[model samples]
Target: MNYFVFGGSGFIGTHLINLLSKKYPNSVVYNLDIKENKQNGKAIYINCDVRKSIELDVPITSNDIVINLAAVHTTPGHPDHEYFETNILGAENVTAFAERHNVKKLLFTSSIAPYGASEEMKTEITLPMPNTPYGISKLVAEKIHMIWQIKKNTERQLTIVRPGVVFGKGENGNFTRLYWGIKKHRFFYPGRKDTIKASIYVKELVNFMLYRIEMDKTDVEIYNCTYEPAFTIEEISNAMMKATGMKRTIYKIPGGALKFAAGVIGALGGKSFGIHPDRVKKLMISTNISGKKLKDSGYKFQYSFDEALKDWYKDNDNLYLK
Candidate 1:
């Protein structure tokens, strides 16, 4: 089988590529990344941006399975337009390419961001109330997949995996911020530390995606990908401390005060708070996601918070990124 993965050099995509390469030793895997995956020599790397379609050295065909994992994730300092171009336009290009080549299956890795930032528990049925362009883009991309699916009239398999905050080695998401800060013994414990984080580890998320692909027979499916049990921010902080074997002072600020301060600071700057706005919001509320749909698909999460943190810390000893 021929497998094509977009953004194969990214945190989650890289791990998935490694796993797929090993799982199907005899199969050919091509990674379409803006940057090459030097770590994985087996994948044929193509340098191109998914936002604008480009001709591939190797043409895609009906037998190929294309997985689109490229997007401007929710992060600090990124312009909203960037998210639109990459998340929506890039997705369109992937679906177009799949249809043009008559690809068999296309898996899109979306986010739980579309479900909005709220203390309320979320399920697959939650109406998407995306607060940021990052979330809106992901939601729009999912729609594009459906649009293309209907137009093509081909037996194209589509699976949309909406993952929560993803973290692991080489990750740059919310988890990275906490892990790095804790590693330096300069962690910030915003709010009362009781806030729950809707999070998922990268390895398990990748496993869920692949397992769904293996088991899927339908034309379209959507699943929320997250850990079985969620953890509180306080629990996570403690786990981080235990992982690093270091004791540090945690500073707690009132949630309401922090939110007010973030708004004032953002107004003063004529822009969104670089990092504090999102952080304060997360610290103030519980973000819970249900993964029952994915869990029922016959996959089990084997890693705990402490174990994931320890492995992540050991792998990235530098711990600090400027």
Candidate 2:
């Protein structure tokens, strides 16, 4: 088997590559990213950008599985246009390319951002009303994939997965922010600490993606890829503090102050959250996505949130604030 993954160098993509390579030992897997290839594999890296309808130089045939994972991931500094271009337009290009090449299957890595925030829990049944350009772009990407598959009568199967916040070893993105802040003993609890948020470890999510591609019978399905257990910010913080033996100087601040400060600091650095703004927002909002569909489809996750934080601390004991 041959597999092609776009945006392969990113954390989730890398995890996918590692998992696929192990599962299909005889298969060839290629990782495509805009950056120059600095990877090795049964698994090779192809430096390609998905922003345009450019033909992949890799020899794609009917048997190959194309996983579109590329995007301008959510960051405070990323311009809205950049998000739309890279997330929506880039998805367009990937779908177009998939159709052109007659790939056997196209799996898109979308996000829970498509569902937006809620005071209540979000499930696959919830209507997607994305709040940010990032979320809008992801929702658009899902629509594009659906439209292309429907209009073309393409034989290629499509699977869309909207994963909650994912974290694991070699973690980047939002998880890294939390990890670094806790490691430095500089993090604080904000708003109500009981705000429930869902997550999946990188390995668990990628494994499920592969499972759906290989075994699931549903056609053109979308699954909320997350863990069975949801956790509150305070619970997660306590877990990290226990695992790392770090002091939790987490002062609960008003949610209004956090929002106001995030705006101010976001403008200044365009990136750094002055007070870990991202974490503050996450702790106030209930963004816990359900994984019932995946479970119903006969899949189980190996890593719990506690296990994830413990492993992170174990691996980086030297980096702890102490």
Candidate 3:
């Protein structure tokens, strides 16, 4: 068996590559990415852009698995056209290549962004109402991959995992910024102390991917990847402290004052600081995504909120706040 992973040099993809290497020692692993892996994985890296036609000379059998992780996922970072261009086009290109090569198994990582920002719990049955360019692009990309799977009736297998905020190793996103904020004693609560942030650790995410791909009984399997109830801001902060042995005096600041301060900080020192005035509203908005579908599938979570933090803290994270 051969594993072909597009955009495998990225955060989640790197972890997937590492796991694939260990689990299938004899199997060849090919990572088609624009850049090389920074964490030293066993997968051979090949520079290939997914937005256009993907050309490679690797031997691929019909049994080989192809995972599409290539996309412009960062919100508020890219222009509207960039997201559609990379995400939508990449999906079209990747699925087309899979079809031509007769690759039966395909995996994709879609985000909970399609459900949009909501305090209400959203499940697989919920209708997608994406608001941002990133969310809209991801939703479209999911549909594109779905069409590929459905075209073959029962012959093609596709697994779509809609994850919330994914954090781990090389992640430079929300969790990493929060960790740095708490460590520096600069972080403070904006409003409601219990805002839910649906999330999953990278290791658990990839492990679940491996589990689901083999266990999927249908031609297409779609499930949410997040903690069942979601983690409250307080819960996440406390876990971060306990895991890293970091001490910070938590203070509650008025939303306006916090926003002003965040604006100044974000302006003075880019997104690296984690706190931005424009993003302050998100701290209070609850993203209550339901993971019941995955939980009911008999896949036991290997790490709890605290355990995931402890593992990430111990690893010292590959990117940002290093």
Candidate 4:
């Protein structure tokens, strides 16, 4: 069977493509994206922009697997319209393309943003109360794919993975920024240390997705993809310190003072400092998620939080971002 990955040039898609190539050596793998898959040259590239009707000239069959990873996910990074334009439209287009090809299996990478900001653990069954444009768009996109799944219920298989803060090599987001801050000793805890940031390593996140897809029993699968008992800020920071051997003390900065300092620095530095009041606010907010569903399914994660950080450290020459 052939494998098709939309937005496969991205961080998670790159890893998934690399893994697919190794695991299914004889099968054809197609990477369709607005940008080319420069890292995985083996994936047959297709210039695809899912915001509009997707037109593919590839030789795909009903037996092929289609994975949609295209979306504008970064919060405060894009205009509100950009999220809907890319996420909602991309979902519509991708599902429509899958329908046209009669593709049976499709996977979509969603986010825990649908749960909004929560200190309580959110599961797959949690009622989505998306607050941000990104979260709302993703929730809508999930329903869009779900509609596709139920339409061809007997034949179609859809798995939606809602991951929280996925980080590893090639990731340029939260964890990477944290890594740099820690390395340079600029990292400081803001007010509290108990802020839970639910997360899963990229390798483990993809591993869980593949595991769900490979199950013999065919069923509509949707689950929150995160480690159980999600790490607190202090826990995450200590793990990073242990991984990189950067054992300097992390000072706890007062919340109000830090916010004022960040605003001042950002005003002067003008985006170079990477310290914004909004960013500080985001850091303090907990994104607690539950993995009980996956765990209940007898799927074993390959990495613990500490081990995941350690593996990431090894992969990036001891500093995961570099």
Candidate 5:
């Protein structure tokens, strides 16, 4: 089967492409992205932005599968309008391409952000109440994909995955920030160390996506892609310390004080320390998302947090201090 990935240069996309190439040596894979990066020799790369209309030189047919992974997803990174421009508009263009080519299946990588910042455990049954522009835009994109599925009726299969914070070797997001802090021996507990942080290792997430597609499940199926029994901040820190063999003096600070400091830092346009009000606020909220749907479907997660951390450290030894 041919695989067409919209955003095939990003961290998750890169891992997915490599996995597909290794697993299915004979299958053809096409990557469409704005930037060109070194990819597996088996995959073809095409420079195209999903924000505008997507016109691929290769012929896409009903036998092929389309995976939409492109989006402006970094929070507090892009302006509000930019999220809508890339996510919403990008979804439209990708869906149009699938419709035009009559692709048999389309898989989308949405985010848990659409569940909004909440202390409650979120599942597939929970109603989306997205507050941030990124979250709102992702929810809208999911709806657009659903519309296409409904239009296609039984001819097309749609799978929507709302992944939590995904982390791996190439990641430079929240988890990476934590790793850097721990490596420097300056890591601290922002508030309650017991606050839950939902996450999935990049490899496990990619594996799950492939498993679902191979199952050939018909119609629309949505799953929150995170490991079961989400890890607490303290547990995550302990795991990282164990994995890297670098134990630090973990300090505890009051939530209110941290918020005030973050506010001052934000006012000063200070992102030097990676501590801003928005980030601090997010840290305080518990993202206790559930992957019960995926679990109930008889899918077993391959890597635990400890295993993932070990793999990350093994791959990027330079990130740690000597």
Candidate 6:
């Protein structure tokens, strides 16, 4: 068996490649990305950009599995066109590769942002109302993959996982920002602590994807990947406090004040401090997504927020001061 991973140098991709290399020792792993992944010695690095069409030097056989994890996912980072260029076009290129090679399985990691910023619990069947470019691009990418699956019909397996804010060690996203603040005892709620932030641990997500692939299910399976009973800001803060044994006063700042500050920062051309107006707005919105489908499929999550936080702290203890 061979594994071809697009965006293999990324956080989730790095972890997934490591797991694949260990699990399938005999399998050849190809890491395709614009940048080289020197971290995983076992992976064969192929310098390729997904925004354009992919041309790999290695031969892709029918037995190979293609996993598309490439996308311009960071909100408030890139322009709208970049999202479509990378995500939508990247999906097209990946699916094209699968079609050309007659690959049996293709797994794609999409974002829950496609369900839009909603307070209500969202399932896979829910209609997508993507507001942001990142969200819109992801939804379109999923459709592209679905088109490929339909073309192949019963012969191919397609797994599309819409994961919510996935976090763990080495992750430098919203969770990392929160971790930095909490570790420094400078974190606080911008508004009500009850704002839901549905999330999943990276390790558990990778494990589930591998498990689903091994099942050899010949059909399209779309899952909203997140931990059960979506976590709130207070719950996450409490877990972080408990894990690090750092009990600091967490104050609630008014949302208006935070937004005003963000506006001021934006006006001043300030991208530092990790508080952009768009990010502030996103923080205020509840991403209450449901993982019931995955749960009902009999997959048990290995790490809870507390366990994952504790493990993360252990790995990054140097970043914290007593």
What does candidate 1's lDDT look like per residue over 17-124, in tens digits? 999998988878888989897876889888879989756878566877889999888565599799998998899898888878877778999988898888888888
Q: Report the backbone clash tally of model 5.
A: 0
Candidate 5 segments exceeding 4 Å error: 39-41, 263-270, 318-322
Candidate 2 positional error at 300, Å = 1.9
Q: Over 4 Å off in model 1, which ranges?
A: 151-154, 256-277, 314-322
Worst 10 residues of 6 by lDDT: 313-322
lDDT of 6: 0.86
Task: Give me the runs in candidate 2 sitting further than 4 Å from their true place.
Answer: 37-42, 151-154, 216-218, 247-249, 258-279, 314-322
Query: Which predicted model would earn the best TM-score?
Result: 4
Q: What is the TM-score of each candidate against the true structure?
A: 0.87, 0.89, 0.95, 0.97, 0.95, 0.95
Candidate 2, 1-322: lDDT as tens digits: 6988888888788778888888888988988888743443556876788986667666778778889989887656687899998988888888787778766688999999888878777778899988988899899989999876676454557889988878776666656677666765545556678877787777788888888888634358899887766777777777777766677577777887877776677668745443545646666788878888887887766767777667666656635421
For model 6, residues 1-322, the per-residue Cα lDDT tens digits are 8999999999899889999999999999999999987787899999888877777778778988999999888878887899999999999999998888899899999999889887988999999999889899999999999999999788899999999888877788898878667766545687888999989888889999998999867899999888887899888878877877876878889888888887897788865566676777787889999888988888877877778777677767735411
Please give the TM-score that candidate 4 achieves against the real structure: 0.97
> What value does the lDDT take at residue 271 in candidate 5?
69
Q: Lowest summed lDDT over 10 consecutive residues: which window, candidate 1?
A: 270-279
Candidate 5 residue-wise lDDT, 1-322, digit = tens: 7999889899889899999998988989988999976854567999889988888887767889899999999988899999999999999999999999988799999999999988999999899999999999999999999999999677878999998889886788989888776776545687789889989999999999899888765699999988787888888888888888876878888878887887887689866667766777788889999978877888887877788888878778735511
All candidates' lDDT scores? 0.78, 0.76, 0.86, 0.86, 0.86, 0.86
lDDT score, residue 322, model 3?
Answer: 28
Candidate 5 lands at a TM-score of: 0.95
Measured on C-alpha atoms, candidate 1 has an lDDT of: 0.78
User: Model 3 — which ten-residue stretch has the worst lDDT?
Assistant: 313-322
